[model samples]
Target chain A: MNQEQFEIYRHLAGRLIDGQLSPGSHIESEQELARKFSTTRMNAYRAIKQLERRGIVSRSKRAGTRVSAPVNPNLLRQLKCEMTRRICVIHSRNSYEYLHWTGEFRRTLQQALAAEDFTLEDVHLDDVRDRAELKEKLLRLTETGIAAFILSVRGEEDEFLIENSDLFFQYHNKIFVYQSGAMSWMHWPFHTVTVNIFGEGSLAAKYLMEKGIRKIAYCRREISSKNYLDFNRERLLGVEFTMRRLSDGRNKPEEWVGLEQIYRNCMENGSGCGLIVSTDELAARIIDYFAERGAKRPPEMISFDNNSEYDSYRLTTIAPPHVEMAQTLGRLIFDNIDIDSECGFVSYIKIDSKLIINHQE
Target chain B: MNQEQFEIYRHLAGRLIDGQLSPGSHIESEQELARKFSTTRMNAYRAIKQLERRGIVSRSKRAGTRVSAPVNPNLLRQLKCEMTRRICVIHSRNSYEYLHWTGEFRRTLQQALAAEDFTLEDVHLDDVRDRAELKEKLLRLTETGIAAFILSVRGEEDEFLIENSDLFFQYHNKIFVYQSGAMSWMHWPFHTVTVNIFGEGSLAAKYLMEKGIRKIAYCRREISSKNYLDFNRERLLGVEFTMRRLSDGRNKPEEWVGLEQIYRNCMENGSGCGLIVSTDELAARIIDYFAERGAKRPPEMISFDNNSEYDSYRLTTIAPPHVEMAQTLGRLIFDNIDIDSECGFVSYIKIDSKLIINHQE
Candidate 1:
């Protein structure tokens, strides 16, 4: 068979073996298949005939072509084994933000990896009872020559991996640590990708100030103490630094750190000022405040993380570059480029933050 | 082997076959495993030996027991086949709310089904190119004696299923139609479950009124034209009906159906009144308004769909009972209870809505 014909056969067989198509089901007509593959009808027929010779499909005058039940299940196993290039995605179990981690980021990463012919397998570290089992799983993946590993984990839950960093030093190059927070350890030397939280704050500040606002308030809810690095503090510092630099160290924006404080500030001077919100959730509450007041024009506002749930609010937001980060990691895996060497001993990669305007897609 | 020993052996083998336990990886110590299973070390050791005998694991004094590479991959197929009780969850591809549908609901359903030793598999209808392919899939599943199927589809995307309703009538008993919107076809005979949108509105109005709300307003963003039933309109009707009945047909709440209208209403007479919002998102904007005004006390507000993203807003919301619905569906599967028989020809089930106060866990 020609290369294109061979590809058609492989694609059809792969779909069947992957359970995308069921046994004994009527296959699409040859003309439809040809249209689908952008191939000639003769070629599609040839592919079907090739499958028929192997007992994979049967053609009948009365019914048309139909997929047959596998005569040998071993072929399924063999086909599965042939797709050995896999990227292992490891994460903590029972993560409250599990959905967030597995949502857009996971989908984008999976799509990016699939484009490179690498399958993504999820391995929950806490799914197993003990640290030993987790280690064993990692060891097995490395032994199997897995292409790359992405560690998408949260605070404290990542303690095991951090503690065992030395053990993984041998395969450090193959590991990518992805966390939204600031990196705690600089010495581990594993390839790291993190959302530029500080940059996001700066971007929000810069964006709002450039819009020619006379005054602004930096609003945040009470900071959670659970994180190893205070992301809010870092973000606040970024905003403060930018605000100072932009105004030649002559101006400081208001900081509304708690609900009561925010309320007091809004009550006293909330009108017509630019606002830099810490997160989308916080921005949502602020939007509600202005909306209820029946303000003719809502204040110029910018927040971090463009959550789709808050899309209608039309709040411009500094969003984490999830897709860009995913694609960058994919490039790292396929190209085997050493990030540290490329960046003069910078171990971690800080993906530039994104500013989504008025919730535009 | 005793029953406990057999269970331990089976559990280990299942883990191995499921790829939860990696091949050639060191197994947890027998004592630790015994502690885990609450069994004696002797039983655990006996189970290990049984696995060793079957060439699934190997034991050595120096390195301890290790899972062995599968000598016969056919055993994997046999074990997989043994899990014949499966629920197929079908949805549209490129569904914008795909994550929402697949997130909490899918997880809860999977957990509920797993409790009954059943597995859930996802099938995207739009992934296939043609209706013939889709029909073939359903036919194959039926031929294989599949346990159940859940159709979690949106408006126009469900046209194919609705059009082919006659073809599916024979398997109506095993088909479940799950949608948040109102069902368009009451006569389809497939078991239906929908969120109580009207009841949610009534409950919100009732809850606010009972709390001595002097004035209440039913607030909603612009109603989308996409839905089969005007959910917002129904919700408003429920609120109005409840308001009038509670106040002896004398009181009617204000209606703010659009953003501009809501803003005008809030600006004119928004304060010190309870608000019944159509969604958590709209409620967020209202909350933001009050917070900005620096009102010492926020207005009593109730909204629909207790989205976690709006948890901080602390708006009392009518939440779809996801876990309860999942459990109910699971019970339906296990008992094979015919709804039509039990409810006097009522084929559909309405799971009660939940009211979340201040985002309580």
Candidate 2:
């Protein structure tokens, strides 16, 4: 194509690809375009002919030139290469306000993507009332030129995705499942990022013992009846395994009923009691309970979910590394954006939770 | 000003207002301006003369027409009015990584502002090595035409801000302090928005009781030695006051040692026992401990901070209205953007924590 023809073709195609010129929209006539661009009618004719040949537009005597209703796949792919900067995050609705760390996860992810001139759009998958609604939503969303889709998979949501597995499997390379631990039951191949719950437990136990906790209690939360994915069991194994190994099979950390019982036992026994709570929320409760009563902080303690809320707390916590998680998702999406699923193997990224110590004594 | 002159003037002022033309930078000469805007040199000269009289630019044979060195007060005010769309958030460095909810707050604020085309720039005020350094950094930042400032105050950071009260007091209308509760010691006449920690406590207790909790336990964490500003007391008072009122002075919730003890006690008591944990973190622990043991979730329970991390937990939680808080701050900043400090009075906005019930029966 000559310079003028190339210019006109690029302008029209760009707008059509962006949906600014929808299907069936009439393109400017050759004479009209020739006047607009200050070019010869022949040049305008050549540009329209080029577009028509590519199947991006159709030329007819009565219709003149109209954008192809279905759009050309090759042209759409080119548009995706240049304009696909949106990442879709799937989670339950209103999780940002209720679910802990989700808001942080989203913020970190958004900030990371924004730096690369990409955007994060949240899709509350749980809000879809039924399987059919979810399927329709996913179909429409996937059809749009989203660079990537991040599914913060939970129980019901996981089931929903699996039900629509065929659609997801087709675009596996473009999908990522951010989970707490690998689900052994469900097996659909996609890029999976898991925070090592077991490692967090092990790390917490080790950190507490190193702080001279003679009697370490792994005070896990009572399991919810609705908990199909119980990470506490995995965490408990890590804590128990680590304690046995560190103590040479002598000192096993006891599973306590609740923080209050542990605190009472520690007070009665008179010090050197360390705690490895299940989550930072639990650890914070322990801290607040002691503080309200004017009691000193325990000799040592650690908890998981190094949630950003407890940054001021003087307690060691196991953080899931939200920033790293977000970055990993961002990196995976970027690397696999153009990759074919056939060549892409299912990648399981397991990141160990870090022990953040804000405790001075 | 004629149409040509106005066009040239608007173009130049917009650039200067946007900080594209920094103070002391030489602006386009009259001849250059005439050629660029395709206007008569006399019209360009008249525009330059208007800018000079407005104190936006100065003319000298050696310097040519240059932006004013000190930048005229009125011109700077106009720049602020037209271009100050960037909000400054002061927080500890690396907070986005470690601190809980701080990242969420920042993200929420950024999203809220971005809708209005405003950008949020974070200032790691705690990263400043010394008080002098902090003062210098703040002086420079405050000098820039920032729309408004939001200070997420903490201990040492709060002290630093207090020490620089004189500077903050001057820009009181344009400054907002987002705090957990009011600090009685530091009396700065700035627009203050505080999350009602006391109300959260009261709400939690009331909700737990309403859930048919007979034997109630108010679990608070042990206070850290570094916890100079203890909010547990405020929360405890709220809980105690509400409990006394609700029970008609017949029953009072006992402050427990930790969640384990509460769990053990509740199990022993055999149902209808309720727990009011200080934070959502603590409440999550109770749920986890119960879940770990395969026990039913305590008959009734409530916690505070409604931190987004524990959204999946079924327990009702008292959540600091972060969205409301951010919106309030944004609204205050926008409404008062052009108002003089003399005409604006200090605003104390207290938002009650919402009771987010994810628990069923």
Candidate 3:
């Protein structure tokens, strides 16, 4: 396989693999091939002879060169099979609505996919409002001749999936949904992955409890945005459940408080008041609030999403496995693409979150 | 190597591999070894001498054969490393409290783990109720010297985790949790997996909307058992979100009506009203009620967790990917066990459910 032969072989293989040069396609004469590659006619003949020897094609001076046709239908399908290496990623409005983390998530995922030789076919659905429009957008995106997708959706858009149910399932083998709100609409199984936000909450409760902090004040945004209602609600439920388990007739905090109230109340009431804030920024601010008023944080404190910028702050927080998640997502989508297995089980992948401790600020 | 020499060599290799014959241990004399495996004294001598040639052991007339001290710490550690293939599995009281799906989930998961050569060490927590007792149970389970776990929790028992948080994190690398109630506890990072019920709800709402049912009544138990409260709540929220998205100037039913009311109200109201029941059984019953009343079920209907037994009923139900969930659980636990990278990402796997439409009664 010399350089010219290798080049010619690769080009032919690509065409054959992509079905452009399907099982029965004919190859050009040696003279015509020589003109195409600007190579000698003898060299073109050698390339055709090589293809003939491999049984990829039948060649003769009288009959010309024709790709070998399969006798069996299954064999022909196998020979004509083309793999989809290009991936189109569509993030949910929720990912966009909360720009701080999800925005970075989208970028990191794109980079990771690119590194894996999966070219990105970006589908912008950041403005897909209401169920009908989301359906239209998703259906339109699927129609763009893209065979693979990584679609993220808030639960609200799932109704659109119900509208395009069969179409989605037909391609479910090639579809991956991340951080989806469509769990209920799972009439069809496919690969779905999300960071376990609810899990993050339970972890926080247990951590504060481990520090032997009794009556831990559960903290979060006094009023979170609507898109994150489910996120905030589920996490709070986890903390409350743990708080109940630990209460044990102990004078635990009576209510879930906001940052200002929790900080003020806990600082004023006592030091045994432990805390679990939903975000690291909120956690750091609570710490700062105490410091500004010439007080130290309660004995126990933990936050969510360990913001690396707050390394000096040294607060314990749950770290989302963003990099590993992107890697795993890429692996699952490519590794599990069996177009005919649409009725098979849907994999719900949950990437582990880390609890980072020890900070100065 | 002769037959006798090969036999002698194999026996010593087995002992060395098993760490039964560690460094500084002296091998018996050739005469003494001749008694074992019925090998000749010469063959035994040859085996020890061969070991000496390979620097695996030292030989001296007085000392007999002594295993050599490892020169490299890494190599020593590699040689000393033992595999942990068994996992301790604990199911929440909630999974048990209900005798239907969750029990099946527990059994299927156990079987799946066994098929993968991973045995489950069932940590009996059926009697555990109080936080202290749950803590005691967890502490006792960990003490069994089993490094790996697959703990399932209802958010209720998360306090016990807080009790043993430190001990849990120390062995966090080997821990896996399924059906976890402790997602809120993200105190330690390890593998955690659970089914996403919220996704199920969104799927239901989408399905109903796709049927063009405007007044979709959300139906569920007026007051479910404490264990399934979060389960029902999250799903209903998914439906409500979709309902809100679908609701325009059209007159919609009041939020979250009871089962009896939904069946009665929707059946009387004719074709415009649809229903998204919380379960297939509930949906089937609702349909039956309409049938019994000599009325046709509304144009649109969707349910959760399709009971395959009701094949004749032909209900569209979201079937939980239990088998696939269990299999994925087993694969993720074993596949992601990077013995070297201990304090790393532990994936929280969420298996996707299937929505079966036109499923026979």
Candidate 4:
């Protein structure tokens, strides 16, 4: 942690990079390093662990640690520049859509960094399945020199990661790109990008209504996070707002559709109904579920994520501006890294979603 | 190149794995090994490179070379088992369907291995844009230690990977799992998991016929690889087969729609047409493109991949038996690995596609 220790590690890393230390060559012992750098053995060990994590060195119990000679220099240089500074991209495995977006985000980031003469060594950590595992992985990355991380915090996991923000920032300055928008409650020194879920919902409703669909139903997941709760509420309000202006006195604008009941009704007779789904993939399933039971097709349907794998169904839906979000985040990270600014505040960047109509209606 | 050198390398590898040579400890120099084994230095160097590629050794100009300190020990051990040997999984960018199937295959393989106290290690290679790159990456894995590789060979790039099958078999025997019914011309000694592309095409044609959609249109990328050509031919045959069957001495199936003309017609009058797409993503885009132009919605539409992403749009489709194929392949690999016999061929596995009808029709 001190400047002297940092300099010593840097010098050793430079030697390893230049092939001077040579992979398989035993690195100077902790005592030798301590004497050379005028540091404690503990500090030297810590530095060695850091190098090992970076894939710069290989350590074994019987074999003294040595620089890894086979480390791709190009990959190393890029990783050292991008990874050592600290940043993480996190997401859950539950939502294939989210997993995909995360992959794209990482790919775009990698491409962007390569363009700027940097390399990104991705550290994939599974979503916090349990509090202990979450804390351990988070701490490991932060303590080992990851400066910033992009995390898709969802449900209760949001609170746990946020509660440990101080611990994370202690190891290095952190930047969080919150995908689910729950970070609004946290006062962390990070930036966030989120889908305009409420806006998307309203757009879906409007598209359905435009096709003379009055009895519109909204289907969404149970809200576990405050942001998702707000999103659900806001979407309802948007649907209500549009319906109030366009509806006749007899019919209300929007109705809550229970997950279980929707399938029964869809199978019995889906005609004269319009549905606004939370996601394109879910909508496709609902459609399949109904068709399996020989249900009439709805006049209009709206879903989300035009680029979803199910796009073959040609669902009219709302699509997130993923490329734009990626570009924006890349710019922000580069700017922050360049300036080395101390400002720690959350800046929410909101982008618009597009409505795509398909043949299936 | 000779059997003797192969024997030597195999002996050294066994010692390395048994910890006779500690990780980060240098092995005999190339010249020394050549003299000791009465072989050329090139053979020794090749062996070293092979070891290096397997993450068993780290080699460099200065560091000399040594075994890699195992990072994922359990993973490495699982990889060493003979039963888990002849299996590989390949992936591509934006090809979520293929990637998802690959993941499923890996999981199935793992489960099968776990039942027999064995597990498999996945060799993931991505961003393979061309044949040269694909062949290079595949050969690298095979030469290192992979016994089999599963790849989605479609297009000219795939041809390159297949063309070099002799080189691949020279290093290690392999089995390639391609897209459904994608393999046609057989030049290599390999088994394939054929998808029922003809069946899917037949089903699509039948569905269109039932709907009285005489003016049917088909859209797909121009065939390049032998697999694609086969898939295209089968689909066309299915269409012709259906039309001939349905013809009651009066009406014939409509002309095969061309992409350029389809785009023009959809732009002019999007309604009153039936279309079958190769993929859900493309179908979604076509729908969106027409909607943006204020064209009327089509009467009937069918797409592929009952993937969740397309749920938003109520579209009829045929879902590939991805999970089934993965499970089958996993079982096959597990069985082969367990046998560990030099007798190297397995019967080709074929999976059927299921029709998933939604509100789209």
Tell me the tens digit of each residue's lDDT in model 3 across B95-165: 33242226567677777667646666666556977666755665455434453766666453334544454
Indicate the TM-score of model 3: 0.49
- DockQ of candidate 4 is 0.01
The TM-score obtained by model 4 is 0.36
By lDDT, the better pick of 2 and 3 is: 2
Question: What is the lDDT for B196 in model 2?
Answer: 59
Where model 3 places Cα greater than 4 Å from the true spot, the runs are A1-326, A332-361, B1-86, B95-112, B153-173, B180-190, B202-215, B224-230, B236-255, B284-301, B306-316, B336-343, B355-361
The RMSD of every model to the true structure, in order and in angstroms, is 28.8, 28.8, 13.6, 28.7
Record all residue pairs in model 1 with backbone atoms less than 3 Å apart, i.e. clashing: A288-B285, A288-B288, A288-B289, A289-B288, A289-B289
- Model 1 earns a TM-score of 0.35
- Expressed as tens digits, the lDDT of each residue in A141-214 for candidate 2 is 75576667776764322455545544443332366777654343123334666665556766777776666665
DockQ of each: 0.01, 0.01, 0.11, 0.01
What is the CAPRI rating of model 2's predicted complex? Answer: incorrect
Please write out the lDDT profile of model 4 over residues A212-331, one tens digit for every residue. Answer: 777877776545666556556555655654554344223344443544577765545447777777667777777777677776445567766675578777788877666666776677
TM-score of each: 0.35, 0.38, 0.49, 0.36
CAPRI-style class, candidate 4: incorrect
How does model 1 fare in lDDT? 0.63
Best by TM-score: 3
Candidate 4 Cα deviation (angstroms), residue B350? 58
- A1-361 per-residue lDDT for model 1 (tens digits): 5545655776776787768777688888889889989999998888787778656788899989887766344345333332245667777553435423747777887887777467888877656666566556655656454556677755333566655553343332456677766544233334566666656776777787777775778887775554533566567656765666565455567777765566556667756677788777788886666567664333577887777777777778887777767766676555542211222121245566777888343
